[model samples]
Target: MERAEQLFVETVSASLENKSVSWKEPLTLNEWQRIFYLAESHHVLPMVYETVFRCDAVKKTMQKESRNLLQFYKRMTMNLVMLQTIKTQEYLELVQFLQKKGIWMLTVKGIICRELYPKPDYRISGDEDILVDKTQFEKCHKALLEFGMKPVKKGINIGTEYEVSYMKSGSPLYIEVHKSLFSPESEVYGDFNRFFMRSAENPARILVEGTEIFTLDYTEHLFYLICHAYKHFLHSGFGMRQVCDIIMYSNMYGEKINWQLLLGWSREIHGEFFAAALFKIGKKYLIFDEKKACFPEEWRKIKVDESLLLRDILDAGVYGYEGRERRHSSNLTLNEVSRQWNGERKNPVLQTIFPSLKSMKNEFAFLKKIPFLLPAAWLIRILRYEKEMRKNAHKNVTDALKIGNQRIELMRKYKIIE
Candidate 1:
């Protein structure tokens, strides 16, 4: 690991473990900047800033060297905390509203995971995820619209899309109402939805600030998180925040979680190796304690390249939005999954140039209503690509191809794909 990244891991580990950070060496301003940027990219700036501020050594160094940067970081973290506070209240209200409308909503991810942190507000989620039954999806959608949230996109329906997103014009509260946990249209992971079939029937209730909210049970919730992370890993990649979620969730509810059942489910999806690797990475670098972590006995024999996995996670940022070139590169691995599902291996470049009609329809929703517009949509897409490739496109494409091929090998190494 690079010095900055190593320091980042150390700082985050200390913060999450509720221990004080001890900086051994004074870092240059550039080094501090890099560390901060990494925290920002990984969406853990609040946690990082909290630990750094609490550390006298790092605090004194930043104060002596650059007071303005320190203040800026403080202000940024405070604003995020404030926004999160408001969002949390709004989310609870939305859940209550849905219940009044006779729609049963089960909250997921951010809302549930945040409570496990030392400071719940530090783990900021970009949006809220709530799962509703497909039968009640339309009613839930109507209720959200009635609650003054506007749909972020058009033509999204339960038949084709797994979730529909909404956002209020003047609020930080964005919502995603999911009819299914995973997209049924997904070629590689369409079967993942089967795991959550009975989720709503026996939902778990969690108390958030004196209000009771529903979520998946311990076993199913943890499995859902793992599956969610694996889904992203197969495409782009997920960042440390995701890893941290696994660590925190497992640590808090390790005893309650059904490790044997979880392991079996993971194996059914061919994600056991990936899941084991996550736990290994957490225990090795992120202060995750396997002794108390109630994992299956067989997991002890599983081996994974933690360094490679960590490197990929850091480079990918949160949900693999680190760089345009990197996102483009990840498409190659996604294409490999497409090939496996369809049982055809086409040239990557050719496939990119001429995507299937279904793929084109996803990009240009109009093509779904008027299939005849596909030709025009293809031409428009090519023109847009040409326009985007005006500067250093050749080098970018070369880099993407190289990185994508390397990541495919990484996927094989982790047994994500056969």
Candidate 2:
């Protein structure tokens, strides 16, 4: 890590752990600006602001030299309060409406995750995720539209195994009704069925704005969080905000969760290696307390390539935006096929060439209105996105595959995957 980032991490760790941060000398304006930018990118600016308020040296330096940063902090605090208020109200209304419709919705992440923060507003959330049963998905979706939430045309899903997003007309809250937690290509895709079943059996009811709503049970939620982070790690990258969520969640429900059960579940989903690495990172960077849960001695001690891991985390700035580079058309297509046709991996290229009927229709929504013109629409869709598909086709294949191979090798080295 760069020196400024290292210092930012150290300062955040001290603040989140409720320890005093004693800087040898007051930070320069430029150094403080860099720290602020890094914290913002990682979605930890509020937490950093709290630390700044607590430290006499930092507070004095900010007041004397970084007036703009202090003003930014003040503005952030105001916006945080307003946004939290809006989300809380929206959460209550959405829950009431869903309950009336008899839709089994289990809230995940977003405001629900923020409840685990030191201050509810410290962890900023852009959207609300509510998991609904596949059986009632259509009904729930229709109800959301009726309740004033309109769907965004693209980006949430390219296939069925993903969430559908909705936004209110004049509100900032973007709500996603999740049919499956992750995309088909994600490592944790196989575990969605098990998680859904678990959610049905052991629902966690949380009180939001005087109304009660359900969320994932502690163990399942923790495992999901790990898998969620791992998904980002593999694809683009994720930031410290995600890491902080895992640590805060673990700390909040230490004894309530059965670590053995979670570990076994993670292994069943091929997530044991990744989970262990995440826990180790959490401990090192977020200062996760060892007493929270009984982590496996061997897993905890599993050596990690810090340089590589940190690079992935930092590059995935605030929800995988920073490190999103285009891939070759063939690589992208192959990846999609492997994800969607997990059982038929022996011939991914062939499977991709002849996609399933439902998949084809969904990709070309025009087919829904004109069934007989499906083939033409399919051709049109490919033609429309062809330029996008071949964006990085000129890059050397070896270079494109190198990064993926390095990630796989690292995972193997840590025994995260076979």
Candidate 3:
């Protein structure tokens, strides 16, 4: 990492520990802006601002820039409070409704994750991830609708354990009701069945706004988080917030977690190398101690450049959509939507043309019970989404192919895919 980038990471990590930062050589306005942009892009602005705003040296150095910076910080704080409040209320209502319907549900990331942070609003999340049993998933979906959570679109990976229903409109809150931990096609963490089964057997209970809820135990959740980060790291990019989550999680549960067991799990998914890489970075910049971790020797010899990895983290803004032109779009292009539907299937075009069962259900809930109407429902979705799909027909296929190849190469570099 560059000296400035290293210090940026240092400052953000220090904020988590409530430690102040001082530089021997003062930073110029340009350097300060660079750090601010990196932090904002990485989705750690609030935490970074909270700490840096208190540093007199930083304030004095960035005097000309302080007004805008303070405005950004204050705006983020208010938005965070409102966003989190809506998410919490929606989450509790949805969970309670699901529970009343006798469908078991577990709150995953998002607001549920905020509890692990040093400050409640330190982590900002736009959605709520609620996991439910596959058998009861439809009922859970019905319950969600009954509770007024609207689906932005059909849930992808319908029958799979990792299907997601996005509540995008009609309400301020977004909820992703997941039936699986990871999709079957997920490269490293394809063993969603095992993770789901294990979680079912050893679920951990917690309180959210005084309501009892369950989630995967700390060790399982830690492994899941690593896998989640690894997935995003490969597909687009993930920022510091994800890294911070792992660090805070480890800080809170390190002693109780069985590192060896987690190591074994990482090996099962061929994720040990990436897991070790994250731990090394986390220890150096976030949390964990190098001497205490039993990271593999091969991890140290990984070929990827540290600077490139840092760039991926920063550019991958929240949820890894940074640098992608799609992030700026109000809605997904046909090709973009197709890319999501492609999953791990070899025939990307075919997958894009044919919607998943869950997706069909999102458009026509009756298909779940009637089954035979799925083909017709698929046709309807195709026609309904046709105009949107046609808008991107002129996009360069060659450029898309080039980006895909680059992603594969980067994934190989990080050992996320071979």
Candidate 4:
């Protein structure tokens, strides 16, 4: 059965890799039948249905796109299968255990909202997200340990310097213990807890096995999802599955979402402008607003730097993973350097550190000043970035120096006359 499931997953993945369910490929009956058969065999009937529905929507004459539809439907079917396999009792049991200790923890994206929908499988959940008081982190960690959930602290835990940012610890249940809701890297220069706590405003309380657990109120949950995505620039990939969940929740529980309250919460976490941008973009791309949620007067007054956010969103997506190389067309090497310098593209020290000759030439002022800097400044920058480079298995100052020398020699050969 496991082998069958694995084979089915691979086949479905291959099908979905064809990027045209909507625009071009019209899927055919044979493809739908194969997907449905696999989905049913795996008890993933819901996924099969979604894929079938998508297939029914395509135009058969659009031959290539029709083929894409077949593949996309199969992918959706497999995604539904993956989502349903999560332990339903994990949230309820954890809530019960914490309740025994008098610790109040509010659930976020992970499993809480996952089950909120009529068909939770449609939401496509990955990890369990919960927010708790800083004081309770140790207790939560201990409790999670009792349940045999381990912490997946791959990167250095963010904000470890700050007492409140101690977020980590996955469990047998497989979860991410967040000190707060947002990514620690992006959490800088912002007060995240205030808005995160405000999720309690219209909190959704549920009783499971005689214990009550509170989650973000439905409307607030949807708004939180939007803000979280905007924070990372809708580049969540499968994480956007959460956005789809929110849309389903919003459409399902329309009145529960107080637009004003949701926007107010957004303003507190991100500036009002950021919140406004999030709402506008969320409504624009994903699920839409039918009742037309009221925007604060301040939201209208706020200025949006689309160009700036576009760059940020692109950066976030480009380097979504650590040491992730961008596609060749994007100048992957330069993108890596850009992230290494902490997104300040023209910081002169980086030029000496990596000697990106092209970028240095672009920032001519930095170049002119670089020649005048004392050798000590050059040493300090190299030493600092070198120590940093030693941590990465990739190019260090030595590699850059070698590459730079080779370029100089090659330039002399080509008569480019560097």
lDDT of each structure?
0.83, 0.67, 0.64, 0.47
Residue 379 displacement (Å), model 1: 3.0
lDDT, candidate 2, at 345: 52
Across 337-360, the per-residue lDDT of candidate 1 in tens digits comes to 777657877886677677777666
**lDDT for model 3:** 0.64
User: lDDT tens digits, residues 107-199, model 2?
Assistant: 887777787766676667877888887788889887887888888764433245456778888887788777777643332254445555657
Candidate 2 residue spans exceeding 4 A from truth = 15-20, 57-65, 154-162, 184-191, 294-307, 326-405, 416-418
lDDT-based ranking: 1, 2, 3, 4
* Pairs with steric clashes in candidate 2: 237-316, 273-416
Residue-pair clashes per prediction, in order, are: 0, 2, 1, 13
Q: List where candidate 4 sits over 4 angstroms from the true fold.
A: 1-49, 53-83, 116-118, 153-172, 183-189, 197-202, 206-212, 217-223, 234-242, 252-254, 261-287, 292-418
**Model 2 Cα displacement at 105 (Å)?**
1.4
Residue 182, candidate 4: C-alpha displacement in angstroms: 3.8
- lDDT for 38 in candidate 3 is 78
Instruction: Report the lDDT of model 2 for residue 187.
Output: 29
Query: Which candidate model has the greater TM-score, 3 or 4?
Result: 3
Identify the runs in model 1 with alpha carbons over 4 angstroms from their true place. Answer: 62-65, 154-160
lDDT of 3 by residue, 119-166 (tens): 666667767787787888888767776776656655533553356655
lDDT of 4 by residue, 37-91 (tens): 5454333345325433433244443566545655666576665556445444555
| Candidate 4 residue 311 C-alpha distance from true site, Å | 12
